[model samples]
Target chain A: MDAEKKNYGKLFFSTFKLSACTFGGGFVIIPLMRKKFVEELHWIEEQEMLDLTAIAQSSPGAIAVNASILVGYHVAGVPGALVTVAGTVLPPLIIISIISFFYTAFRDNAIVNMAMTGMLAGVAAVICDVVITMAGGVLRQKRVLPVLVMLLSFAAVRFFNVNIILIILICGAIGAADTYLRARKGAGAK
Target chain B: MIYLELLWSFIQIGLFSIGGGYAAMPLIQRQVVDLHPWLTMTQFADIMAIAEMTPGPIAINSATFVGIQVGGLPGALVATIGCVLPSCVIVMTLAYVYYRFRGLTMVQGVLAGLRPAVIAMIASAGISLIILSFFGQRELPADLSGVQPIPVLIFCAALVILRKWKVNPIYVMAGAGLISIVVYSAF
Candidate 1:
C-alpha cells in the first residue's frame, strides 16, 4: 500500500514536470512521456507506449493530455488518471493565469509587441515542421489509399471549408467499410 | 453571464476540436474573433505565438488568454476547466474500454481514416498560419499593401534553419524575437 502511494506521488510529479517544461505542444510530449514511463520507471513497455500514443492521437482532445490519462490509468486506474491530469494541466493553468492578470501590460509593451511579430514567423515555421513530419509518416506507408485520404482531407478543409469533424467522420466511415470488405474477402479466400 | 458563455464556448472547443493542439486553432479563431469579437485578428495571432512558446497545449493556452481578456482571473479558471473537462471524461471512459477492444475492426478503420485527416488538418493549419504571419488579417480580399517584408524574411530564415539545420524550435523563436526587438527598436 505504501509502495502504491509512493508510485502515485512519483507519477503525479513526473507528469507535472514534463508538462511544465516541454514546449512545441502535443507531438513533443510523446517522446518525453516515453522516456519517463518506459525508460526511467520501466512501468510500461515500449510497444504499449506506442499503442497508447496511437490511441491518444486517434481520440479527441489534446494528445498530450490523452496520453497522460491513458498512461496514468494503465498504471493506477481512475485515481491515477485524475492525478496525472491535474499535474499535467496545473502548470499551464498557473502560468497563463498569472499572465492573465497582467494582460494589459503585456499587450501594450512595445518590446513585447516587436518580439511577438518575430515569434509569429517562428511559430509558422515550427508549424511547417510539424506538417512535414506528419506527412512524412503518411508517405512512408507507401500506400495509395492513405495518400488519397490525406489529399482529399486537405482539399475538403482548405478549399471547401468543410468542418474538420465532419471530414473525420466521413473518412472514418470509409475506413470502416474498406476494412470490413477486406476482412470478408480474406475469410472467403480461406 | 460572461463566465457561463466562456465556459460553454470552450466546452464546444474542447469537444469538437479533434486531432491535436493545432487543430483547435480554427475553432478558437472562429469563437473568439468571429463570434464574440473578444480579440482582434492581430491580437489572436499574438496569442497564438505566446501559446506556442508556453508549455502545454495550444488549446489551453488560448483558452486562458481569451478568458482573461474577456473576464479576468475567474474567467480564465472557468474557461480552462471547460476546455479540459471533455478530455478528462472522454479519455477516462475510453481508457477503460480501449485495451479490451484493441482489435475491433471499426476502431481500426476509424483510426486508419482519422490519421490522414489529422495530418491534413495540421498542414492546413500551418498554411493558414503562414498566410497570417506574412499578411496581417485583412479579410478574404487581403490588403496586400499592409504586407511586411521583414516578417516574411524572418519566416523564410526560420523555416530554413529548422528544416536544414534542425535547431530546436525554442531557439529559433527566441532568435526571431531578438531580431525583431532590435530591428523594430532601432527603426
Candidate 2:
C-alpha cells in the first residue's frame, strides 16, 4: 500500500515534468519518458517501456495522454494511470488558459505567423521520424505479415481513400490469424 | 446548451480518436470548423500552431481552447472532461482485456494486427502534414504549382538532421521558426 502511494506520487510528478517539458505531444512523450522512468527510476524495463509506448500510441485519444494512462497503469494500475493523466493534462490546461486570454496577440503577430509557418516543416519532419522509427521496428521483426500489413495500411489510407476504421478492422483480423497460425506452427515444430 | 454541445462534440472526438496525435486533428477540424462553426478555419489553424508550440496532448489543448472561446472556464472544464473521459474508459477496457486475457491467443493476435495498422495511421497523418507544408494543400494535387520551397527545404534538412543526429525535435522546430523569421524578413 505504501509502495503504491509512493509510486502514485512519483508517477504524478514525473509525468507532470515530462508532459510539461514535452512539446508537440504524441510520440514525443516516449523518449523523455524512457529516460526518466526506465533509465533513471528503474520503474519499467526497457522492452516493457517500449511495449507500453507502442500500445499507448496504437490505441486512441492523445498519445501523450494515452501514454500516461499506460505508463501509470503499468506502474500503479487504474488509479496510477488517473494520477498520471492529471499530471499530463494540468500543465497544458493552465498554459492554454493563460494564452487564450491573449490569443489575439498570438493570432495577429507577424513574427508569430512566420514562426508557426516555418515550424510547419519541422512538424512534418517530426512526424516522418515517427513513421520511420515505427516502421523500421516492424521491419526488423523479420516477419512478413507485419511488414505486409504495414505497407497495405499505408497504401489504403494514403492512396485508396479507405476508411481508417475499416483498415484497423481488417488488420485486426489479419493479425489475429497471423498469430494463430504462427502459434500452431510453433506447436507442431515442438 | 453550449456546454452540452461542447460535451457532445468532444466526446465524439475522443471516441473516434483511435490512433491519437495528428490522428485526432482532422476530426477536430471537422467538429470545430466544419460541423459547429465553433472556430473558423483560420482560428483552427492558429490553435493547431499553439497546440504544437505548447505542452500536453493536442486534443486536450483544443478542447480547452475551444471551450474557453465558446463558453468560459466552465466550458473549458466540460470540454476537457469530454475529451478525456473516452480515453479513460477505452484504455481501461483494453488494458483490462489484455491483463485479464494475457494468455489468450486471439486477443494477442488482434492486438498484433492492430499494431502495424496503427503505425500506418500515424504515417498517414504525417503525410497529410507533409503535403500541407510542402504543396500548400491538405491533399497532394496534380499541378504541383502550389509547392512552397521554404517548407520543402526545411522538411528535407530537418528530416536528414533528425535521422542522422537524433536531435531533439524541440530544437529543430525552433530552428525552423527562426529560419522563417530571417528568410521572410529578407524577402
Candidate 3:
C-alpha cells in the first residue's frame, strides 16, 4: 500500500512538472502530457488521453488544468485530481505573486525596463510563430471559414474594441451552425 | 469589499476564460482598465510584457498584478484563488464523468471543429499582443527605428535555438535576464 501511494505521488509530481514547463498552453502541453502520463508513467491509455484533451478544450476552463485533473483522476481518482491541480497551480501562483510585489520597482528601473521592453518584442515574435503554426493547421484542414472568423474577431476586439464575449459567442455560434449542418447532411444521407 | 471585488472579478475571469492566458487578455483589460480602472493600459501592458518573460501562464501573472494594484497582498490572494476556482471545480467534475463516454462520434466531430477554432483564437490573441507591444492606446509609434533591435533579435534567435535544441524555457528566461543585466549595466 505504501509503495502504491508512492507511485501515485510520483505520477502527481511528474504531471505537474510537465504542466509547469509547457508554454503556448493546452495543445502544446499535449505531447508532454502524453510522454509523462502515457508513455513514461502508464497512467492512462492513448484513447482515454485523447478523450481528456477533447473534454478539457470543450469545457469552460484552462485546458492544462482540465487535462491534469482528468489524467490524475484516471490514475488515482479524487485524491489524484486534487493533488494534480495543486501541483499545477501552486508554482505559478507563488512565482507570479512575487513578481507582482516587485513589478513596480522593476518597471522604473531603466536597465530592467530596457530589457523587458526588448523581451516584450520577443514575445511578439513568439506569438507570430504560434500564429504561423496555427495557420498551417487550419489551412491543412481547409477550415478557412473558422480561420476567417478568428481573424475578424481578433481584429474587431483589438482594433475596434468589440466586446470579447461577443466575439467568442459569435464564433461559437458559427461552430454550432456548422456542426448542425453537417449532422443534418449526415442524417439525410442515412 | 476590496477582497470581494477582487474575488468576483477573478471568478468572472475564471469562468469565461477558455483557451489560455492570452485568451483572457482582452477581458482582463476590460476589467482592470475600463471597469475597475485599477491599472492603466500602459501598466497592464507592462505587466503582460513582464509576464511573457516569466515562466507561468499569462492569466495568473495578470491576476497577481491587478490584484496588487487594487488592494495589495490580500487582494492578490483573493484574485488568484478566484482565477483558479472555476477551473478546479469544473475539471474535477468532468474527470468523474469523463470515463463513461470515452469516445463517441459527435464528441470527435465537435472536437475536430473546436481544434481549428482554438488555434484561431490563440493565434489572434498572439497577433493582438504583437500590436499592443508595438503600439499603445494613445498613438502608434511611427517606426521601429529607435528600438534597440539587437536584444529583440537575440531573444528571437534564442527561442528558435532553444526550441530546436530542446532547452527548457526556464533556462532561456534566466539566460535572457542575465544578458539584460550585463549589457544594460555595461551600456
**Predictions' DockQ, in order:** 0.68, 0.59, 0.40
Q: Write the per-residue lDDT of candidate 1 for residues B1-187, one digit (tens) a residue.
A: 9999999989888886667777788778768876798888777877788787789988888888898889987888898889888888988787777777654457767777677887787787677777777886634334567778888999999989999998988899999999989988988
Q: Residues A41-92, candidate 2: write the lDDT tens digits.
A: 9988887777666566656688888878877887888888899989998898
Those runs of model 2 whose alpha carbons end farther than 4 Å from true positions after fitting are A1-14, A24-59, A70-81, A142-144, B1-5, B12-48, B69-71, B93-108, B135-142
Could you give candidate 2's per-residue lDDT for residues B22-116 as a string of tens digits? 66776687688768978875566567767877888889999999999999989998998899888888777767775665434576567777778
lDDT tens digits by residue: candidate 3, A76-136: 7778777877676666667777877787788899877766655555565555555666668
Off by over 4 Å in 1: A1-4, A140-144, A186-190, B140-145
Candidate 3: regions farther than 4 A off: A1-16, A19-29, B104-128, B135-138, B141-187
- The RMSD (Cα, Å) of candidate 3 is 4.0
Candidate 2 clashes: the total is: 0
lDDT by residue for model 3 over B42-160, one digit each (tens)?
67666766666554566767777788878887787788778878877877776665666545455445444444445555555555555555553334468756545455565577568
Model 2, position B114, has a per-residue lDDT of 76
Taking all chains together, the TM-score of candidate 2 against the true structure is 0.79
TM-score of chain B of 1: 0.86
Binned by DockQ into CAPRI classes (incorrect, acceptable, medium, high), candidate 1 is: medium
> In each prediction, how many residue pairs overlap at the backbone (N, C-alpha, C within less than 3 A)?
0, 0, 0
